[model samples]
Target: MIDTGEVRIQLRKGGHLKLERALGARVTSVRGTAWITAERNAGDVVILPGDSFIVPCDKLVLVGPLSGTVTLELQGARDAGSGALTHRRGPIAKLWALV
Candidate 1:
């Protein structure tokens, strides 16, 4: 489920998600690998697990899994309350803690 402040999405191989006017939003790869390409950007970015990329401008952005399934966390600029960031546990993190 997507909260008000952030969104978590899982994409299968060959599937993609599009975000429009997502300026300054931070996209983090929680699992697997994904590729990010933004409109007006010169190049595409590949993010592995635990990697994050900040959208540089308000443009159309596409994110897709490079292989297998990919889980992503997107936090918008307004999501940062009082300029402080909060950490949330992903499934992998939770599983790791139980191990």
Candidate 2:
């Protein structure tokens, strides 16, 4: 378990934040709305206040505010080497596993 203090990041309009070498991050929008884009993921995500987004590992993520300034709370990266974590599967794989 990694103990970390809460961090607040402010993003101006059309501003972005680049993160590297992080397993993942738990991000919450405290004020206004934020737009998030990842390396492997297509399209942009809009998160509003009281909402959260997870930034996956091994990818570059860009977070920007849609308008005005957005206040975001970062809870740090995920734990390393936790075997319980698994990749997402398609519907076919899920059905096969049930057999």
Candidate 3:
């Protein structure tokens, strides 16, 4: 899916952000540098301005800034040609969590 705009984030050096699968975020560095790590994925990724990294939907991810301050643009995944959030039906609690 594609997004026309993006969510912005700012992080200080050595600071981290916890991510959930609901976003399916595609993070693009706007300034400084950032390090990305996924719980179910091996290895770490570093991105500078103009670089982007995709976050998988089935795992947790941590994003940390490597520079004094880093700016990022986050684009969330959604159904193609649709604006609503959609996922497979699961337990009631999990389904309500999306709300």
The best candidate in terms of TM-score: 1
Residue pairs in clash, model 3: none
lDDT of 3 by residue, 1-99 (tens): 544345676778766666655345588999989988888687999999999988765566777788698897766645443322221221122222232
**Per-residue lDDT of 12 in model 1:** 88
Native-referenced Cα lDDT, model 2: 0.64
* TM-score list, all predictions: 0.72, 0.70, 0.68
Candidate 3 lDDT (Cα, 0 to 1): 0.65
Residue 70 displacement (Å), model 2: 0.3
Which pairs of residues collide in model 2?
A: none
Cα TM-score of candidate 1: 0.72
CA-lDDT, candidates in order: 0.70, 0.64, 0.65
lDDT tens digits by residue: candidate 1, 1-99: 212355677888877877665567788999999999989899999999999999897777788899899999877544222122222221221221222
Ten residues in a row with the worst lDDT in model 2? 87-96
